[model samples]
Target: MPPFSQSTPISNGFSPNHHHQSTNIITIDVGGQLFQTTKQTLTLAGSNTLFSNLFNSSHHNSIPFLDRDPELFSILLSLLRTGNLPSRSKSFDLQDIIFEAKFYGVSHLLVQSQSNPSQFEPLNLEKSMLLPLSGRNPPSKITTTPNGSLFVSHGSKITSFDWSLQRKSTALTSFTGVDSLLALSSNVVAAGATDFSGLQILDLDLGVVRETLNWDNVTKSSSTVQGIGSSHEFLFSSFESGRRNSNSIVVYDLESFKIVTEVARNEIFGADLGSAIPSTKLNWVPSLSLLMASGSHSGASGVSGNVKFLDLRSGNVVWEIEETTDCFADITVSDTLSAVFKIGVNSGEVSYIDLKNFGSYKSWNYLGDARKANNVKKEGLGCKIECHGNQVFVGKQGELGLWSEVLMGGSKIGKDRIFRKNVLGRAKDLGGNRITNMGFGGNKMFVTRKDQQCVEVWQSSARRF
Candidate 1:
């Protein structure tokens, strides 16, 4: 039947035609083009129901005018009435339906498929079954070492998984209350805890503690040591100073097992640089020799924030950009030497920093704002940023956003921004509201939600060169 001649019945009222209803439904025109119902409903109770029943009852395979198979027709009807389907129903093949729904532009079905790819069995046969229980929890962080082995951080311990074999090997013995982990190289991984001992280097291959370096003796409560990056011989760790004007960055010489140097923000930038402001977070880019970026809390008690880059070789500030007061939550660097920072204002904003083209003192630009597009203005307190090649991924308040660079002149010019383009797992609403941290390994993105006990993983759509 033509789309203009078809109608579907509902409990509330009668729709003149599926194509002319207020609710959205899947429709196929005479030419085989698909469309979503944006407007009316058709009630079949009076006369249309009898005809539908007669036609459905008489035809098993020879329904000459019906456009879709019986099973597919039922699924489409259910989706049109209810925004989503049950995650684990065995009545019909969900994978096929998901594809059909996506092809037909069913918004709700697309969201459901993304959140639970495993719901459609045959289509997602090769995909992993592990997924977050809800949309509020974050995924786990993953790192691949030089030896081609994979390490995934869940809660306080690092679990080793083999990529070739696709199985878990062994869980590394961990430090007390460690919350974050980073693979410095094939043999070395850095672990950070909420306590103030700074960062610890764990040998994943040997499953032993290689070295532990303390940041300072202060031991502030809930103080997290983050952004543990490394070079051939040195490991750098940054911390959010719990007290005013006290946050510092510690560099450890992996060979010496001693703190090579600890620089305060004032000394690294200037005594008056962020005097009114305190350091919130810091990150180091391995490709840029002795180059580090630090985000500071807006002066004293205000809402403004600033991020400054320092040249450790010269012990001087290279570039500093003051931003509208927002909580600078996390920052990360890509394999290509690009950097990204997550700024939590009334809403969240991401800034992409191109180290290759930055002058001595140039301000970075905001890549995009996720919250503004969603029309939601919630504070992004617990958020993390990580990059893989030209793509940057961020987790804010349980939602994931993906950004890709638009390069020009053989340099990264700007980013093509897509907000809430993907979601990993659900988050549990704890008052702490912390979107703990994130990392990447072998085409997978991991995110940790502190309030939620589990870590979630999302498969990357990126194709490796």
Candidate 2:
């Protein structure tokens, strides 16, 4: 929708011999602009890629990318034709080009878009990222894979990436309302829909999906499946019972694909509907074998929420901690645990919670330090945080704030935050983009952006590594 015009396609300028062109030549219309190229180039990225499949199928020659930009696709075609990335029309964005390259399955183009120094000047910030990991429809859920890939859930799909920051695979769900996502294995993903009836298991590579959770058997009409978490062999879903038996947490055995236990119920959600119900975003920490849930939601009186530690074996509350904050945006568990959430509903403030370990609930008093952002009203959004070494990386919808000084240099947290005074609150703001979500794996970081339709991946520079 931004003002951009298509450049004369590079393919139109190329000339080929009659006999050679007759058999392998292909033509396609992109955004009303026509392009012609050889089938060789189209099938070069032959394995499971869009082009390969497109050309190899019955609908090869007349493929339509009507919604996609012709100039960006031209840049992509040029990138594949010549290893050197072609110049853009200046009206388009570098991020947009990067996304087009990914969709067309040009792997090297992603590296070029991130590594090219010329493109880096426009949106300058402190360098911890390479380019971006991916571009999707606002990926709000991110999880690290067993092999260190980043799995992100946004729109109607889940996109996966390896540590190299290359997008390995993508999975889609039939349910339009996606609530939560969990990476169950290298190739399979588990997703739950908004109303608890649309739970699914998706196979990433072949794009096969099986609805693993039966709504009719366990769920009533009012039940809502808020979030999903997983242990090695088990899956846990937070169920909000609207009118049925007390609100509960349900567990499913992954091996048998059957309902194993009703983990915990009334104890956690004692109040019936109309009364305040405690919300805990479900996240399972594999190392500790504990399902971690925490959140703060607004109430009639004030903000109310809790950080609950639940036992997987017996469905008991191992520990619980309360907080006075807004709802949690997301939670991730690694060597260290980090949870990104907002302050109060209309405060336009966000916080990052850090936990050393999932030990005794009483001893786990660690909390996220808050940061205030500027240029936003009461209805505006807050930052999304990702855990890095000792510090949490902050990104709002508009820009990235790499404020290492905010929570840096402290080996352990104190009662009050140990601010890196000289550098505190000073952040390198990377402008002109809306960052929906970001994740780190090995030295690579994946950033999802709104302007682009692909995930941008950043490989760490020597300074950050």
Candidate 3:
């Protein structure tokens, strides 16, 4: 059956093609797409949403929802009436559908769109699962040392391990919370605490604290230590405030553990930085010595999150990508390739930004059609995304999805493998759990789960590379 053919039941946004009395019907224009329905149907979501707000002042016909996509709205309307998506556009990706559904408050439609990926391209399967970190301590963040040992942080406690997953030593075994962890050198690790402990540098050999550094003229909060990034010499961490007046990101000399400089909250382009503004994540590009930070977006453009790239050499922000919808988080980089992921913290819709072209934001694209994946929701489950080299990893609780080399520049999708929530076996068979942090080094990947008592490490099969 043709979805848009003359014989279809929906004619001009009406099911029966019957003209309704003027006072009994309402027409809406979404991105120039036409929709007609009675006022009674729009009241299902109660009075706090877009449609309910416009109900009273809406003209009898031809109400306009400017800047909205009509195809999605049409689908949303069909879902409202029929309680399911229309049979039309079988090839329609779910991202746009989820976005439209969310925008229109079609709760049921959004739920249907977020199922696991049932179909996937072929893959060279691994008969044996790579499960390391069996008896390791509970971890909130994981990173590797220069020589290939793993440093797992569980706030006040830290654990060290060799490539073989043998536990070495535990440090700061008394602290209550550690928020983020970074490897500084072969025997040194940097930790940011959840309490006002600021940042601490530890000696891996001694399993002892070496240096503790705090920001200058900055107040500490429970979330003050959100994330941290490092280069060969400088340690970058977050501070608060919006304007360039107070520092949002601060640079410190790693060797001396002294304040190097403060980065104003992206006020470099003048002060129109948007809501919920805070430097929550940071990724420092090694070869270029450039830093990419993710925070609140610019309200002027109605964008939600800001991914700004800063040039450490020139001490200036070169470019930035302002976006909304996707959760701006866990930014990661590999060689010339950097991946920025947006997840529906409350929805399961996840997508990644494949930024290449030598640290330029202008040369970037979403690896998969994020708009379609809008249906893939984690809801309040909270997700963390990790990208190393060409591979992309998305972790939500115990569930994990691995997309290896799925980025093919110019909005093209590359051929890749697809694995479901069952890859990480936990409570039963193979399923997901809470994954808090992921780190990569020496062709090995380490995953940490907040819900599980021990961390997990996976090594690439010799043949997969």
Candidate 4:
């Protein structure tokens, strides 16, 4: 996505498009930081010596440059005094103020920044780095409820918050031992873990546990539920066997609490002795009841991986998209249209396969790869793609790195555009920490860093076009 244009005026009175404000502000100390709240009561840090020298030296300068913007300075002061950013500011520069607030441990300012888009700069580097530092603890998965509430899962506890109200609701502690939880719908939720003890379902409305299906006796070994997807009546859990001898996708009827069908590689694809087997990643289309897509190795030993489209109603493989291997990463289905995008982590390529064209002769094609042909001599990796709406956002890593999106048909007419937005690139100290999970809801994007305690939430006004 392109960075939002700078045409919008700073919500605060002072604007880059306009001259400085007419107020004569004096410094006051609040929350251990010096900020100018008004002309009187000057509680300047370090004393008048520095201020006098600064004022005298900068007299010839066009605009007086304080350490930061005066409005942000006043807002920070109000936050320090009352634990809230002053809601009265006419213009707010979010990115710049947020970084300062995070560094200074201004909790209220951080919360206020989430709601006001006018405060935000288009693509600010300082604000992006300071986001994960604001939260008290890191979240494993962060999801926004349909009503615009932010729900964060940490360890076994899930907490919900009204971001606009700045209030945290009661915690849902029923999922004590579960490793992960996904909101299936507005009222239904599912959680799973690595102990191979099956899964747990909860009714969010009642805040009570509805069901817990144990698979310990059936599987006879510990298994990690890798992925979970749901239809209207049924919930599907995909598991990789703890014994490493079996890999299967098990379907369960949520209403009946029984395994309706157990799909294994051999049964689904009819594996041959000499053929290559693919590793399996299960995904379901929410609108289609019996439709499920599995990316797996086509051979017995997983030498060749391909995506298989299956019909769960008959427990039969209906179609297969072949020739690709090692296909595993973030997958998203367009909420507004009929499209599915599979982002390849290692391949640095995005294969856009249309669901409508699946059964036809020309089904799959390489939409594009980040690594150019001429850059084959370089040792570095390319970009990662995230499909949202009609655009596919790509994040590249480097000091001068960028995030761009390719419009679906824009590439063909030589009108393919690139966004100049910069994402939170790879962090140096986060050992073994990769981009674990991501999701989009409302107008916000949530990203979870692996092994980190907090999730980063970015608020944007731009919608997928």
Candidate 5:
């Protein structure tokens, strides 16, 4: 069936053959080969695009000529009509299609067809492909844009892969290593390290630093970034004084990179464990209008940490939790789930706190065995946990676990709230190097393993690479 076809009936005794040549029927000549399509289908290409301009032009009767390949144009026409590529498009390289899409000013349409985030399937993810970095150093951090472009920091360099995952570019920075990285745009990224002086806004295409942001601490010394995060309008960086006595989380204007305000500023007084622990992880909860900052410290006694949800406007901690029992190895907040999740360092179990009744429930609702909270072996030493879509992904050793909520057909939280967990991938995909980090963009999950130089891409088998 055609996407759009308007048949005008013969009127005033006009013949059907004469009506067949109506202005609604569009004909195009690409490389001297003619193709026909309806004006309604071409209008879907959106305004300012080549197709829209061609149709909106004054020459309706004359066939438009385009100095392009007819084969690729046919595929693009199919896309405009059906909002998907034909099966035969597999024969052509993805790069060629991307180039043609750019020429037609319809690259966004191609991206929508291939890498939409709504297409992410947590259950069907498989170890599909590998993105190899060009150095001996393993990736310290990986970040992704909403459209699926990836940025990986290995040693002092950052490598970026386009949304299609076909082309990549590398840029070097002055830092010895990048401990935290956040992608601000397709070409700009905020990179920082614990040992580095300031957070650098880098341009990946030009391989240059656009601007450097630093915190004004009481110590009057340089500030090093512990973590970087962003909300819709603001960029947040957790910075600790080089003297290691003071720390603060600075909020900046995303557009201008100017310091808007500071929150969670702490100056360590003698033996105050809470003040000594600077937030190493920052997550913005858009739904609740809060920023969660968490950090942990290890000493001879045990590991202790704190998680604080701050109202940025007032610079006040709206909700706070102190961890003295089983400190979290890693933590992530799921806005869709309205919960904050963590994996305990000693228990090796997942836990959560309901954001709806946050202050009332001071204790974490352990999803697994609560008895193991006092384990001596440190079972969750280097585990990583992150939340994407409505699911939580946990990386323990070399294995990956997926946790999904079992809808009980109720909106309120009950005592028997259940979340089922399943190990991701087959047996062959398990038991490799220890998983270091994980990131998600578009329909793909990017995983980096300890001592591994390449980033593994886990994606749905149904989506074409």
Candidate 6:
């Protein structure tokens, strides 16, 4: 709230005859201050909200009164009208606005206004803040919610931060170290560890284990979770037996938590490298209705990997790509670009395959330094690659690189599509600890570095305030 020269109330230009001029006009008294807006504007707050309830009961004879901060109400009213916060809102604290919005039952409106996915700009992102964690263990895995809330697992504990990044809580888990963490809801998370048995569904708020999901393998040993992912209707978990002889991707109903079916069940025989590998990454491609399961294994021969596109309905591999030379260090699928991207373990260069025309391209299309394809130094050994919106983010060592598709009108896509790269962050933020994990939520990118014991938040500068 800004200081005023006089104690005048903030109001729209509505006079005594304003209601007569427009029947849609409605007046609201907030903390003794008068505010006027249209019924249609209040309806944007959604049904059952305070504003919506007021719209239903509003009468021209009696003005609706709300016992709340006038300044905050004015800001929210501006948000309701403009689908964004006004420049003047920069003067107020974001937490105050969030609390006030919740009171008015318009918290979702505020989230949409502030963290809408359309506002994510790869070029505009910069290191905004650092969220510190307890203990010496760095973040092993991290997950995020659509509303921008995040859950990070370090050692045996998981810390959660709300969408605003203002309030946070910590939860202790049963795992020795959480290797995989997925946010099922704002207050619930599915946590798994490679060395621990079963995927634990935890309640972050109460710090309790809600349930444990496991794969009943024939070996009769405990099933260890390798990766966890979710689509709209189902949750997928890659589980390997304690004996490391068998692995499978188990699918469960997202709502009921019941076993739906299993896919990619592989039994390892003596020295069978292909059947021995287990999926360490699971990504759902909603556009094509396929689940991308990728994993790599290092043997005496060299680093070898496989990327399989699995059809959940039929439990069959729709497409499979064998990675023999210069295998992927990290891989991700971008639904927006309709492509599968990977960072080579040997070359350390970004390569992508067009999913739309899968048969047109026989090999990976290198995005940077194709000459380094034969490099034997394993330049991309510990890198992490992820996609959010249309931009692809690659974390190599301590540096962040952004890959964006350059749109060309009336141009072919598979062979002629152009992609450009840009280095993210400033000179000071370029190098420090090696990046270990990266995830996206809302409009922000969450990055955790090796031995950092903190999560770095990268967001657009335009939305900083």
TM-score of candidate 2 on Cα atoms, chains taken together: 0.55
Candidate 1 local lDDT, 188-271, one digit each (tens): 677776554556678777777877666453544333575565567766676654443445666677677677776654322345
Scanning candidate 4 in windows of ten residues, the lowest lDDT window is 1-10
Worst 10-residue lDDT window for candidate 2 reads 417-426
Q: What value does the lDDT take at residue 333 in candidate 1?
A: 58
Two-way lDDT contest, 2 vs 3, winner: 3
Report the lDDT tens digits of candidate 4 across residue range 246-298: 45567888677688876644322243421223223445665454454454332
Colliding pairs, model 6: none
Model 5 spans > 4 angstroms off: 1-21, 57-60, 411-414
- Writing each residue's lDDT as its tens digit, candidate 5 over 101-198 gives 99998898999888888888899888988999998999999999988999999998999999999999999899999999999999999999999899
Give candidate 5's TM-score.
0.94
Q: What are the C-alpha RMSDs, in order, of all predicted structures?
A: 17.4, 12.8, 25.2, 14.3, 2.9, 3.2
Angstrom error at residue 457, model 4: 1.7
- The local distance difference test score of each candidate is 0.50, 0.54, 0.57, 0.48, 0.89, 0.88
Write model 2 residue lDDT over 82-193, tens digit each, in one string: 6555545345665566567678777554454334433322112234444332444666566665335677776776777653443456666675646677777767777766
**Model 6 C-alpha lDDT per residue in residues 79-174, reported as the tens digit of each score:** 888899999999999999999999989998888888787877888889999999998898999999998999999999999999989999988888
Q: Score residue 356 of candidate 1 by CA lDDT.
A: 53
Q: Please, what is the TM-score per model?
A: 0.53, 0.55, 0.57, 0.53, 0.94, 0.93
Could you tell me the TM-score of candidate 6?
0.93
Off by over 4 Å in 2: 1-154, 158-172, 215-219, 222-224, 241-246, 254-256, 267-280, 285-289, 296-303, 325-382, 401-413, 416-429, 450-452, 462-465
Measured on C-alpha atoms, candidate 5 has an lDDT of: 0.89
Judged by lDDT against the true structure, how good is candidate 4?
A: 0.48
Clashes of each: 27, 14, 21, 25, 0, 0
Output candidate 4 Cα RMSD.
14.3
Candidate number achieving the greatest TM-score relative to the actual structure: 5
